[model samples]
Target: MKAINPKTKTNWEAIGVKPHIEIPQTNALDVAYKMALNEVKKSVSDEHQIKDINDKLEELSNSLPLKEK
Candidate 1:
């Protein structure tokens, strides 16, 4: 297997390392993928809540006027 770092143009052999390894079991990989997907979904929900808070803050700021300078 060929391993190259694009930025540094270095090979794994040059770094004194082996790049190829055994593949992961299918069941373990599937479970990890599912967990990652759930985390991403939770993140998206949190982002929506943040956006709502920001919108409310902007509305409140617009409603209140600053004292004349």
Candidate 2:
């Protein structure tokens, strides 16, 4: 009996394989956080409010560890 090679004869579609789907690389939390930050910056016109926002952003950024290359 001859053995069939699975790699060369596999029907990907028959197994419900999908190649058209695109996955996002960015974290959803990061995207939502940036959107919220932008909206906050746009709505705050007072110097103190802007300063407070900047301070909070700086504090949060400093709290996270840097990613190594």
Candidate 3:
């Protein structure tokens, strides 16, 4: 590696400088992929439960009185 000189260059040393080793960066795509997988897992688990929730919401909405107020 070429030696860096403060007088000849900027006063900062920017190469190979890490305070601590960190985990590799995961970008937005990685986060989105994980979230989608989680949602799919939840949706696939006990489909009857999801159906029951939808049925209850439908019943509640149907029983409500609509007003133009």
For lDDT, the strongest prediction is: 2
Mind giving the per-residue lDDT tens digits that candidate 1 earns over 1-69?
677889878786746654243234544444444445545555565777657655654554454333112
TM-scores for all predictions: 0.30, 0.41, 0.30
Q: What would the per-residue lDDT of candidate 2 be over residues 1-69, giving only the tens digit for each residue?
A: 544448876454445545342224344344445447768998899999999878776654554343213
lDDT of each: 0.52, 0.58, 0.49
Superposition error at 30 for model 2 (Å): 8.7
Write out the backbone clash pairs for model 3: none
TM-score of 3: 0.30
> By descending lDDT, how would the candidates be arranged?
2, 1, 3
Residue pairs clashing in model 2 are none
